[model samples]
Target: MEPIGHQTGRLAAFDSLRSNVAGTLYEAGDPGYAELATPWNVAVRTSPAAVLEAATADDVVQAVRFAAANGLAVAVQATGHGIASDLDGALLVHTRQLAGCTVDPGGWARTGAGVTWKTVLAACADHGLAGLCGSSPGVSVAGYTSGGGIGPVARTFGAASDRVRSFDVVTGDGRLRHVTAKSEPDLFWGLRGGKSSLGIITTTEFSLLPLPYIYAGALFFGTDSVADVTAAWSQWCPTLPPEATTSLGLMQLPPMPGVPEPLAGKFTVAVRYVYTGNADDGARWLAPMRAAGAPLIDAVQTMPYSMIGLVHSDPEDAMPASEASCLLTDFSADAAETLVGAVGPETGSPQLLVEVRQFGGALSAEPEIASALCHRDAAFGLYSVGVAAPPELPAVADHAAGVQSAMNAWQFGASLPNFSAGGGAAGFAASYTPDVLARLSGLAAHYDPDSLFRLGQVPAR
Candidate 1:
């Protein structure tokens, strides 16, 4: 997609950007421009006319103002883990150089747009604190929170955006503003779940969980019990209390060194659990899942909070990926059967991992104020992920979508922001209800009257 036919003359502003920022300015001829513009998903081919590596928040302000003055659009990217569309011809603000992190032992931390979850997790661990990290800690914190971060502990703690204290953003009008619940209320509410359609977030502050250690990990089961174990887990999860968070995954892992001996080169079922309460209670809560089937690996145990990656152990390497997410009100008996029958062990599923996380607990409760995030009352979150570059990967993504559509009768109102991909305006709009979208639209109009930040995931005016 080109720049909507309005990128006529931005030479003067682009010249100013090249002269002001300490970071490198990459144009069409730059060697690294192509690689840097591409996203982790790889499906969308981002082709920014010029890429500005923002060394500080001021650079972001300059970039936005330059885009506005020159009639060019603006887009933001950190790790590219969540890009939904090609940033074609937009002035891409690369936040990688704005890396800054400060952890306070008082159970909170402030970070720059370029900071990733892994860095925050390590910093918080030093003070016996924990940041609400997703399955893969490599994703950027600002990007994750901008999408209402639904992670492993989502059921217990709710969305990561709920803990946000403030956001330092560069509005499309070329202004740097500090936004919070009390200041710029609409922007504050919209930014929490609106992604990047409204403005460019340069820094954010969020509260941390007081979890220094947790009884969390996954228990892998062989294919023979995949159906039985999955059905059992499905029934068992609804009865879990607020302290216990759980999800089940159907995986077709290829034989690889990092993969355990029993799991690789075959299909398997993994019952992942995270108990934020006492260790003894966590163990008691996991007993049913442990007894569900003969396990290949039982890695669930009390471990340091920083070791939370053991629960899912999502791939760390960059690769082409395709993903989809939906909310389910409840997985009834019929729904459970439908899910298992469609993707059961004997079905020869091609997905790398098909996961269903039991939601409720804190997730069902609303934040103190209204926000753009929708479908909080859904009973579960169904997500599908598969490699997209390999020859067989297309089939895998299709099968995963099939499994998801099989449960469409129970599909909730919208998709979760974290799991949405390349949705563009329609996709981002799906994450919110009509009212929330309206409010976000109003804020976008007020702050970005020129409509510069309309790439993906931001509600349209």
Candidate 2:
């Protein structure tokens, strides 16, 4: 892995790129090699031939052009929160330094690709507004939006991509372009769900809703109540109005400092909530779920939108993680029984968390604009996460696969881009319909005839 030496003819072109871009370019032996190549998902080791810490949009264009000219592929990452593949000879463009954000109180915000959800949330908070953010605010806004972000409020507000107004991107073509519903409609449609497969998103402009406060948080129940609570939630969610969105989690929390005393080192059930309506009505709506089981901690309460993270507190630190997810068409009583029998509290599931987010209402409604995002009709999404490469990893991944297999009867559509790994091109195809995938491939070919951005999950032409 010595810095792609002179023996390779591409070195000369790579060297020229190093001289032109304002960014720092590092090869295999560089001091930053270890740090730049490391991703948030530490399971897959990334071994890019060169790393470019792009300082400006121009630098991104230059890097793509160089990679294209030198017969090298390109891959882009900001926080590396959702890396799906290991980068081998691909030139990795680290977008962490492209930070910039602007909040237009009228209704929207524009952010650089590197900007995280917290940045937009804070800026929108100044205007008593909120962006459609994920469980954790640490995820990059563009990356999250591009992957059709689904969160606690997804059933109420729909995917983050649905709220997007525009995107500034560097396509695989080595050209920078602006994309939106009206201009470059095909690119706009593809970028909304196509993600980095088509290009590296430089910046994204999206709508922010007027949500000052919300009735949101999680209600924790003990292991004794897991069966009762999960069963009730499965039936109850289908009846929920559009204003309320919810998810249920089966968690086995370590007895760490942040762990609530009652839930420490125990298998517990948590019903996460997010209500975008009147507080009193929201409470009344949640009564059925609250009455499902005697909650260990009745933490759900009305709070400012800024505190929404309390509902589904994703980890703040980067760790080695492997996840599997799929959209479900139904969670019938029989399915629920099967799930509980397999991975419920008594079974001692190995993963850190098993979650099912109810999807319908606004999420099922098609966006006004035609975009590549598909599978809106799915009723729910199931996901599992655990440490990768740990001693128990093999068993954990196996158990997760078993859980997935058990739910096959309820699985309606493909896995989400943000949650799926393996299957590569097939995974991308599964995320959308055949027509949408074909359209995306056409756009990619038109924008990037050279196909420099084909390192990971790009649509096959």
Candidate 3:
């Protein structure tokens, strides 16, 4: 079978594609094709030969089969948050129409690929249940979990993929499989950390926590106090138990609405923390940081679990952005000094946000069902983001490189999938070990012999 040519807008197999699926199909020049094909990262221009707005798992199966038959590669997108590169004339499967979400009071959730953490958070709030959600609840549950989601409460609960019960996916071979630890175990393990490398996830089911509330929020200190506050935080993290999750970010927030006046248009350090324990104990654990320095805004307090979104308060609006990331073996005081000197106020960095998130506790331990998720013992996650624009974007990458160079001594040499979105083959390669990548590539060969899933973050190719 010859590989599909670079044909855009129309195809010889359009009739069969339309007949086999209930979802709408669009060519490049079609009225809705632009909107349907656009990704969350405006930086990536996806120009697929065809787009399928999948309405069902069966629709996904049909789309894969169609791509296989036509000798075309296939790509999957839910919220487009993980768009790595432009899809050049491939078949794009958009799972926006698979909006199914159901929660059991017994502390479990099942969601279609279209469902986001916001939807799951809202639904589960009614039952005092909480799903492991990343900073931005707007991200798709399936997409996030598939990439081994590292959420705000990750120190306590571990990665979202660790909590997964099962996944209903359409593999590259055109089969709709119901996968679990006991059934199709290899597929189950591969799908968890492989992202969309193995298949298009149609629906996902995962376990949830039953806490009604948490003692969580952010403590903001002015840049003038960055030195003092950072020192306190660096010293405090080592003493934290598994129930206490925390991170510190240096923010360069614009003076927009919802942005506090103190932090807007100014350099500030935000110490974000979440405690799963009781209020008194949580406060006792957090007391030193509260007294670290005179905070401009101290919002840390006991709040309902439903308000968990406020802890990180990540940007919800979709816009173009560039990011770089790496894990750390340890964050020593010397590393802290190196980081502050690298991207702090003195550096005049163009990047919008720089973060050093603590990792330990439950994150270091593997779950009962082991998976392909790697870098479990990483001590911290260091990431940076900048506005992606015509002239300034290049500087972001350069500046990020300089920062990583400054902290090279503590580098863990790997990163989580959620943070490696725009990273190329090297970035993707750093995400897993040679053994895991080899296993994933082997599985991709067996499950996707034609390399139909080449467009995802997977380095299967």
Superior candidate under TM-score, 1 versus 2: 2
Clashes of 3: 0
TM-score of 3: 0.97
Q: Tens digits of per-residue lDDT for model 2 on 396-430?
A: 77888899898889988687777755436777678
lDDT of 3 by residue, 1-461 (tens): 33456343345577568988999999888999998888887766779888899889999999998888887889888888888778887899999899999999998999999999999999988899999998889989999999898878889999899999999998889898899999999999988888888999999999999988999999999988887777788889999988999989988898989999999999999999999999899999999998988899989998888788898898877677878899988888888888889888888988789899999889889878888899999999999988767467777888898998899999998988888877876777788999999998888888887889987655656
Q: In terms of lDDT, which candidate is stronger, 1 or 3? A: 3
Off by over 4 Å in 3: 1-9
Q: Which wins on lDDT, candidate 2 or candidate 3?
A: 3
Q: Highest lDDT: which candidate?
A: 3
Reference-based lDDT, each prediction: 0.83, 0.84, 0.87
Which residue pairs clash in candidate 2?
none
- Candidate 1 stretches greater than 4 Å from native: 1-13, 390-397, 457-460
**What are the RMSDs of all candidates, in order?**
2.6, 2.1, 1.7
- Model 1 lDDT tens row, 1-461: 22334344345446677897777788776788877787887766677888998898988988888788667878888998877676777888899888899999988899999999999988988788888778889889999998888788888888888999999999989899999999888889888888887898999999987888888999999989887788788788877898888888988888887988899888899999999988899998889888989999999999988888878998877677767778898877777778778877778766678888888899889988667778888898888777756566667767777887888888886887777764456667788888887877888899899999877545556
What is the alpha-carbon lDDT of model 3 when measured against the actual structure? Answer: 0.87
